[model samples]
Target chain A: MTRPSPKIGVYGFTGCAGDQLMILNCEDQLVDLFGATEIRSFVMAKSDNHEAELDVALVEGSISTEAQLKHLKDIRERSKVLIAIGTCACWGGPQAMKLGDGKFEERYKKVYGNAKITVSKAIEGQPLDAFVKVDMKIPGCPIDKQEFLKSVSKLVAGKHPYLLKSPVCLECKWKENKCLLLDGKFCAGPLTKGGCGAVCPSHNLPCVGCWGPTDDLNVSAEYDLLKEKGFVPEEIITKIRKFGGSGVMELVKNLEKKEAKK
Target chain B: MMILKMKKEDLPAFLESAKEWGELWGPTTKDGKTSYAKVDSLSQMDLKATRTVIPPKKFLYPPRFTMFDFDEEGFVERTGDVPKRILFGLHPCDVHGILIMDKLFLETYKDPYYAERREKTLLLGHSCIPDDKCMCFATNTDFVAEGFDLFFTDLKMFYLVWVGSSKGHDLVRMRADLFSRNLDKNDILNYTEYRKWKTAQFKAKIDLTGMPDIFELGYNSPIWDELGEKCLSCGQCSMVCPTCNCYNVVDEVDLGTAEGTRDRFWDSCMFREYSVVAGGHNFRDKRADRLRLWYTHKLQAFIGEFGKPACVGCGRCVATCPVDINVATVSTALKEQEVGK
Candidate 1:
């Protein structure tokens, strides 16, 4: 007996819809993707979206508003498995760089000076795991297309997706690219999680840490290396904060704590 | 070993004739970096290049390639289309590196993929000038006698060619007119003088004497943690090193169908996931542990199994590592019990 196709719903929240656009960008595999799964609710892809129970819910963007948070909780209740797709949902993307800085309200006032009424209350951007249980995460500034497809295929087959946890340096070395750090340049390749194929380094550029921090990274070592290279501590932190989000923020904070003890 | 003398000017003609056997590949310099590239003739090659960014192992086991294509029926092994080629300009250290790989891949439990590539490709060794980073002298891989089909030792005006295998003799026979069998006493004296000169050219002093013992004794040393702290875990050293042959295989499935390709890509022990087995238990989770494993395998474990260290001392690690955490530094640190600046 043939089993029915898995019901997958792709949703987007506060950030730029690049992740959703990435799904649409799978034009070549769009037919195969549609044939392989029942896309019950993808508002950007289809007008007729069903808000019913889903086998898999792929959520993009971070929770930055009360409405988005409530909607995410509802989606979590309805979906059997929830996957955070893109850096925004995984680590709150660049938007959540200042999440723990305690300046969200001040920054909000700086951006939009005291607007009277609003459809939803504004809040600091935070990853999906901050509010609800995220089964898996496909991290990137915008998730890699091939990685996204691989994750989807595994999910549809009822298997756990195996993502690489190595840093960008692995991929960079595989590509035979010269290490930017050797040139005394600030490169985040050693600290940033790979699966981006070391795209920036392949072009002779330093990694921007857009995929967030890898687990158990030597953050203090990287900081010290950068500092030794004549980069100021503030400058190094700013560069890391560009796309490092809360994951890297926590690592940097721990590094600071350890340094303080010394 | 059949020794033949060839005039330096006749090299291009000999190489041109050798192309009839297979596609010619030699070290070619581009953008200040030397790498092995397919060349039509000797003129396209940079024979003076001491090393390529990647060694000849890439020809046998590529960085990444599809091992097989799979479908609903079954998996189809990808064996065909491995082109026949003559890889030229390999240094003595690189040739030694290939010999170690041969014992690993072609010996017990032979890897058919590597075997096929090895069978198709012919190794042509060349003499090199030792730079400050070259450490083959310490590893005793500065002079190779066996592994390659042909080894050309450049002695200024003339070339002393050693034909190692029958395949290499066949290439010589194809251009028998260019090679001279007439060896006089002067030629022997010239070769001796050349050997003395080459020996004095080495600048880097690396002593791997009792490396296995040193590695064992320093297993619990705090030096590993210090080295690990400086190591980026980029695996660049592994990639550039001639003997690192670890790889990971993944079965990629197509979106809608139950068919795709099984890809094999280079993996490094420095990577955190290298030791992670099923159930998420990481065997070498700490960077220090991974660093120790890499050095131990190269210096101690391989010596225990093969009676020789795995390191060819090609100096690729010395040149490639960003933070100076290569074999030279690591070995020196172990011996001195202090991390180098």
Candidate 2:
């Protein structure tokens, strides 16, 4: 008996919708991929999408509204495997920066002076995993297409694909690219996750930690390095929070405290 | 040494013919960044490039090289396959870097991988006009005395070539039509004048007056702490360094098949795991300690072993560092510091 294709759904909440566009950008391979996987729901790609039991759910963007949160819970319940794609979904992106900074309400007023968002109850941005279980995370500003494709294929085959746990420095060294940090340019490559193929460094640019912190992140080393480079604690904290999310920000605080005591 | 002249226009034809010798690697421009790349024709060679972001050391010591392929039966180790390769447009400082690297790799424990490449490769050196960041003159490596097969000095109208080796002599013999033996006393004087002019261009110099003693004495100096504070531990300084030869080897097995390949890639001392041993005993755990080791290795330790510092004064480290950590400035700072008598 011929088995039915895996029911896969694509989604977005509060983001630039760039990650979904990245999937569409795979124009050449999308046709073959569509033939293999049963795309049950994909708002960005098609208007004719139905809510159904999904084998896999590829999610992008941060949850910033009460409506989005309820919808996310529904999707989570329907999907067997939920994959967080992009920095927005994995770590809440730039929208969630203020949540940790303790200036969310003030910034909200600054953007919309006393005006309440009517479409949905406005709430602070949070990653999908904060409310639901995320089986895997494909991290990047706009998730890397190759990595996304690889993860999707592996999940479809019921195989657990082991992603790189190392930092960008590993691939940068492998590419033989000169370090921008050595040139007195601030780079987050040493602490940020690899699998981006060291793209920024290959072009002689610094990594901005868009892919988030590596598993073996030496927080103290990075903090001390930034501090040595004349970056103040506040400035370094801001840099870390850019893509690291609240967890890393907390780790940064701990590292700072240890540094201060020393 | 045989002296010859090749016109500026004839360089392309010469490089095209040089392909008959081996695969050619020279400077090429892409996305506003100029770097050393394999060239098929003269047009691909960016001869006017100041310096590549990373040196041509990758050709000799690649970032990731397969040591050997193995099966379940037994393991086999093989030397580097760097077939007859000619690296053109290398500057004098970089040429000197390879010579210094030779002292380390070719010493008591000869590295078969490096040796295989060294034996098969030919270096073509060129006189460099120093820019603001260049400190080769300070390190006394601006002009190479030896270690290159061919050295080319740019004279206004033509290139004044000096055949430094029998390999270069054979090239001159093989491509006799490309060169002119019509050299006079004026050419020598012109070359000397040009060298002096180029030497005067380098304003940056690392004064070694008491640097050796200063480096030795300043082991416990607070400067190391300051360096550690600013250093990002990115290891880019060593990556761009032509003389640095540190590497790590790992066995990678193909998941589908039982076959595997032992591969070696560039490793940096700045890494936290570089000094980590079994049972997680990290010797150089602190950033300051790692900084001290790097500076001391390049300045003091290398001098003790090779009678010269490991730094070739290519200034790639100084120029590439994101934090503007200038080695020359650091040395000068150390020299000027008043240590406890």
Model 1 lDDT per residue over B1-341, tens place: 99999999999999999999999999999867788899998889998878888888999999889999988788999998899999999999999999999999999989989999999999999899888889888899999999999999998898999999999999999999999999999899999998898889889878999999999999999999998888777777888889999998887776666777888888889988899899999999889999999999999999999999999989998888877888899999999999988
Alpha carbon lDDT at B251, candidate 1: 76
Docking class of 1: medium
Tell me how far the alpha carbon of residue B91 in candidate 1 is from the true structure, in angstroms, after superposition. 0.5
**Candidate 2 lDDT by residue in tens digits, B1-341:** 77789887887777777778888888887765568888888688777766787787877777778888887688887774567888888998888889977877788788778888888888998777688888887777888868888888889888988898998777667778989999889888998999889878887756765567888888888877766666666677778888888887765544233355777887778777788898989899877788778877888888888788888888887777665555676787677663211
Question: What TM-score do all the candidates reach, one by one?
Answer: 0.97, 0.71
Looking at candidate 2 chain B, the ten consecutive residues that score lowest on lDDT are: B251-260
lDDT, candidate 1, residue B62? 94
Q: What are the candidates' individual DockQ scores?
A: 0.58, 0.16
Residue-by-residue lDDT tens digits, candidate 1, A23-77: 9999998998998899999999999999999999999999989999999999999
TM-score of chain A of each: 0.96, 0.94
Q: TM-score for the second chain in candidate 2?
A: 0.93
Q: What is the C-alpha RMSD of each candidate to the true structure, in Å?
A: 1.7, 6.9
